[model samples]
Target: MIHKILNNKCPHCDKGHIYREKNIYFNFRKPKMNKSCSHCGYAFEKEPGFFFGAMYVSYALGIAEAVAVFIIGTFFFENTFDLRILPWIAITILLLSSFNMRMARIIWIYLLKGV
Candidate 1:
C-alpha cells in the first residue's frame, strides 16, 4: 500500500503508472488519463466521481509533508521559526503536490474496493 501510494501507481498493481506524462503539473490543469494501464490494462478512472476521495489522500500527504518539515527543522536545524525555512517548506510541498495528487487518486481507488 505504502509503495503503491508513494510510487504513484494503481493501488492494485505497481507495474503500471498512474499517469502517462512524467509531469502532472502540466496535465492536471487540463486533466487527462491514459486509456488503459500500460502494464495491466486497468482503467484508472472508473466513473465521473471516482476521484473525490483523492482529496483526502492529498490532504494526508500535505499534513505528512508539513509534519516532516516541522520535525526536521525543529530537531536538526534548531531554527523552527526562521522565515528562511519557508522556501524549503514551499518547495517541498510544490515538488510533492503532483505526485501526491496521483497517489491520492490511487489510494481512493483501493479504498473503495476494500470497503
Candidate 2:
C-alpha cells in the first residue's frame, strides 16, 4: 500500500506511473505526471482542473502532519508550547513538502476515485 502510493502508480491499473519523474530524492523537480496511464490508458486528469481540488486535500494533510509534529515535539521536549520546537516543526514540514504533495494527490485520487 505504502509502496504503491508513494511510487505514484496509476490508481486504476496500478501498473503505469503517474509521474514522469520517479526519483523524488535525487531530482529536485516537481512531480510531472502523465496525462493518461500507459498500461490501461486511464485518464489521470479525469476532467478539466480535477487536480485543483487536491489543494484542499493537501491543506488537510499538512494540518494533520503539523498536529503530529506538535504532539511529538511537545512530548519529546517536555514542553506543551515550546518556542524551541517551532523551528523543528518548520524544518520537518519543509523537508517533507514534496512527499506530502505527492501523498496528498494520491490521497485525493483514492478518496474520489476509490481505492
Candidate 3:
C-alpha cells in the first residue's frame, strides 16, 4: 500500500496509475490525474467533491515541511529563535507545493480506499 501510494498507483488495482504522465514535482502547471484507471477502469474521484479533503492533507503536509525547515535551519545556524529562518521555510514550502499536493492526494486516496 505504501508502495502504491508512493508510485501514484490506483487504490483498487495497484497496476494502474492515478496520475497522468507529467513532472508533478517541479512543474508549475497543475498536475493532471486520470479520470479512471487505465488497467482496471476504477474511477479516481469517488464523488463530486471527494478530493476536497485532500486540501486539508496538503495543509498538514505544508505545516510539517515548514517545521522541518525551521528545525533544520536552527540546527545549521545555531539560532533557535531567529526570524531569518522564516524566509527559508516559506521558500521550501513554495518549492514543494506541487509535490505536497500530489502526495497529499495520493495519501488521501490510499487512506480512504486502500486496505
Put down candidate 3 lDDT per residue, 16-106, tens digits, no spaces: 8988965656766778889889999988888888889999999999999999998888887866878989999999999999899998888
RMSD (Cα, Å) for all candidates, in order, is 3.5, 2.3, 1.6
What order do you get sorting by lDDT, best first?
A: 3, 2, 1
lDDT comparing candidate 3 with the true structure:
0.85
Worst 10 residues of 2 by lDDT: 21-30
Residue 56 alpha-carbon offset, candidate 3, angstroms: 0.5
Estimate the lDDT of model 2: 0.78
Clashing pairs in 1: none
| lDDT (10s digit) by residue, model 1, range 2-101 | 7665555765567877766666543435345675577888777787887887898899988899778877777656666766667787888887787678
Task: Indicate which candidate wins on lDDT.
Answer: 3
Error of 1 at 7 (Å): 4.2
What lDDT score goes with residue 84 in model 2? 88
Candidates sorted by TM-score, best first? 3, 2, 1
What local lDDT score does residue 5 receive in model 1, on the 0 to 100 scale?
Answer: 57
lDDT (Cα atoms) of all candidates against the true structure = 0.71, 0.78, 0.85
